[model samples]
Target: MIFLSMLRLMVHDGFSLTDATPYRHLVSGLQYLSLTCPDISFTVKKLSQFMHSPSKTHCQALKRLLHYLKCTISFGPHLCRHPSHHLYAFFDADWAGDRDDRKSKTGYVVYLGGNLIS
Candidate 1:
């Protein structure tokens, strides 16, 4: 759904789907995908490095991603209503975790009033 949403956005802006493939713009695109489809963020980011030179396997993987989106259309995040207004956050990082680049992975999520807005 995340990729599809990006595809939708570009198409809505009058760009042809094929030509709109923004593999060249993975950083921003993947960040948007993280927000729109948090469940797939990790996997999406893992695959992002190959954007500049995507292989047939990558194309097939993207197609599978689209299929997963279609199958899970009804799933979505739900923020419960509550009276508390406290803000809470959780974060984790693994330094030099990427096998290929030895770059660290940083992940975080914040909640305000029991709602995760970031």
Candidate 2:
């Protein structure tokens, strides 16, 4: 159940599906879940990109994601107490990670009082 990362090697060369299992809906629901489950945010973002033209491979990746979520349904974030009122944040980016558009992949997590706020 430890989906350390959802860095799938997806591409835009796959065959499109006509009756994809309502991928847009499923991914949108997952998007809502990612609000609390920060771990799945990146994967959901990746999946959401195919809403316009999803393929069979995308569906498989989504099934794996759903399976991981079901297995980790009981897990939650762990927040520890701190002595100071300082805000801590960390971010990372992969510059030009997207081969299609040369867009960067960036994400950040904001913590307040040892709690993740974003």
Candidate 3:
């Protein structure tokens, strides 16, 4: 699930539309999974935007995400028992990065004692 920074997904990229049922189901489940697997949160969010009418490319991306998850099933965040009192936050924004909609995208993550909290 390595998304290139320059990759831009469009609603109509000449690829045929795919069945929405399975895509919707997988995206929904991935939404829940994102709670524990923050690494895929951004990808899942991007994929969910096409739920109403997912293109073949979107379906392929979803499959690739699933494969990545399968291969990294054993990896997960570990919380320390005795965490430090330090709190850290980081964020970045892509100004008008969405080529299709020209909308800016931003994301942030918060950590407490080196453990991701948000």
Candidate 4:
């Protein structure tokens, strides 16, 4: 599953990633893309975890993301002017989900007029 891979990517530095790259631009660029493409937001967030020490594997992931973006250029969430009347926010927290750092994991999803806005 992609979720497992995302977690795996962060847990252990890729052994195959011997060649590190200065990839701030690529990572930041993909981060900007997350604004329009929510689908890649999680992956971009995962990639950001290693901004200080990006590896060759990270660069490859960035390249793959760029290719995916190019292929689905038209796919992006839209904010309708005539949005529904209701706006709401919901969130969840898992206390210390990561065993390594004991960092609590939190997540949220906001909706406007029953449409997922976050």
Name the best candidate (by TM-score).
3
Q: TM-score of predicted model 3?
A: 0.62
What are the per-residue Cα lDDT tens digits for candidate 3 across 1-118? 3865315877774466645798899999999999888788898898898887888888888888899899999887777765487889999999999999999999998988878888
**Per-residue lDDT tens digits of candidate 2, residues 24-74?**
889999999998887888888988888888888888888889998888898
TM-scores for all predictions? 0.46, 0.58, 0.62, 0.53
Task: Give the TM-score comparing model 1 with the true structure, all chains together.
Answer: 0.46
- Candidate 3 wrong stretches, greater than 4 Å: 78-118
7 in model 1: Cα distance from truth in Å?
24
* Per-prediction backbone clash count: 0, 0, 0, 0
- Candidate 1 ranges beyond 4 A from true positions: 1-28, 88-111, 116-118
Cα deviation of 15, candidate 2, in Å: 2.6
lDDT of 3 at 99: 98
Lowest-lDDT window of 10 residues in candidate 1? 7-16
- Superpose all Cα atoms of candidate 2 onto the true structure and report the RMSD in Å to 1 decimal: 6.9
Task: Compare the candidates by lDDT and give the number of the best one.
Answer: 3
The better candidate by TM-score, 1 or 3, is: 3
lDDT of each: 0.63, 0.82, 0.83, 0.74
Tens digits of per-residue lDDT, candidate 1, 84-109, equal: 99999999999999999999999998
| Candidate 4 lDDT tens digits, 44-66 | 89888887777666767777777
Give residue 36's lDDT in candidate 2 (0 to 100).
88
